[model samples]
Target: MANLDAPATAIIGCGNINRGDDGAGPAVIARLAAEDLPSDVELLDAGTDGMAVMYRARGAQQLIVIDAREPEGKPGAIYEVPGDVLAAEPVHGVGLHAFRWDNALFVGRKIFGDDFPSDVQVYLIEAQTLDYATELSGPVVAAVEKVAAKIAARLVIAPEA
Candidate 1:
């Protein structure tokens, strides 16, 4: 049970629906829309607006962002990382978007100040394909559901007395 009334918790999912697995982020976010969340949480469908995601995260006590990442792991694999860890991790090569998650963290710092919220977290799901004009493949659709559950679990809040 986490505090849900401190600030808005934003879940930003980015991707191109026309593309293949690149749409994983957006797909997960879409699934979340069907659920009933605490009034303190906000879910945004920020397609490719990695930087803009930070704007929505300002003043949040806990911010959980969900995106698709290509890590050295199995496809559909999900990674849950603290926002600080994602921010501190160095960039070794080109990322999905020019900014990517690193940029999002940086923007978060700039917008909310250096020690930006302590509860920020990222939920990254491994992506299989990034085709520009294809719909999400079969595996990704299933993966989105799993990721959605993970996101919900993370956002869960206990009732206040």
Candidate 2:
């Protein structure tokens, strides 16, 4: 259970490291984990688990999600999307593996209500490939550093009431 009285920011990364660029999210989380972030911020490497994303985000004052987007002509392009714009209701009957962070966003709001953070930001990195591999493409590696630095900078800012 989350402590409703404690105000915190949740940063969740979702992805499959086994798939080439799909590992961007976890990569970012790994980088942030080594940095000195604010005490009020909680970082999670959800690793393709939407349920974990929702549970981890509970009671957070803000939520930031990082993931890789499917290839669409460009590689390593970063898109900062508002959560509401990407949030989708979970489809009934789908297995847990099919559930995604976007679905978690909708379900979390419905389940947690005011306990869930309304300030949600999603950063998507366009992938060059989703093939079975351990190394990230050159462009993705650069983008990961940029995204990690950007998130770290954002965490330093004081939260608004």
Candidate 3:
């Protein structure tokens, strides 16, 4: 069960760490874990589990998600997109394992209504590769630091509503 006194903000990272740059999300979470964030902020290493992302985000005033995207010629490129712009309904016949963070945004809003955070942000880091590996590529490693710093900076002054 979710705590009644949930954190004011939830930051979720989604990706598969074994697949090279796909690990960018969790990598950022790792970086943030060492920081001194406010108690009203929560950091989650969702690691490709959309259900976890959806349930964890409930009752928070804000949600921030980080993930890696397929190669687009520019590895390490960062794109900040509004959650509403990326949210999409899950396909009807797909298994839960196939569910994604975008689907979580759509379903979470429908199920949780106002309890779900309205201030949602998604950060996508362009990938250099998704091959089997345990480490992020050189460029992605740099982007992880930048994104982590950016999120940490935001949390410093973020309202505890």
Best candidate according to lDDT: 3
Candidate 2 is scored at a TM of 0.91
List clashing residue pairs in candidate 3. Answer: none
RMSD of each: 4.7, 2.7, 2.5
lDDT of 1 by residue, 1-161 (tens): 22233356777787777767777888888899998877777788888776666666666666777777763447777788877877753356435467665576766676568335567778777777776766766666778999898778867887789
Residue-wise C-alpha lDDT for candidate 3, range 83-103, written one tens digit per residue: 999877655844786888899
> RMSD of candidate 2 to the true fold?
2.7
Number of clashing residue pairs in every model? Answer: 0, 0, 0
The Cα RMSD in angstroms, rounded to one decimal, for candidate 3 relative to the true structure is: 2.5
Best by TM-score: 3
For candidate 2, write residues 1-161 as lDDT tens digits. 56564448899999999999999999999999999988888888999899988888889999999999999989999999999998876557446778788988998898889888899999999999999999899999999999999999988867688
In Å, residue 97's CA in model 1 sits off its true spot by 8.7
Badly placed stretches (over 4 Å) of model 3 are: 1-3, 91-94, 158-161
Model 1 is weakest, by summed lDDT over 10 consecutive residues, at 1-10
**Candidate 1 error regions (>4 Å):** 1-7, 71-73, 89-97
Residue pairs with colliding backbones in model 1 are: none
Which wins on TM-score, candidate 1 or candidate 3? 3
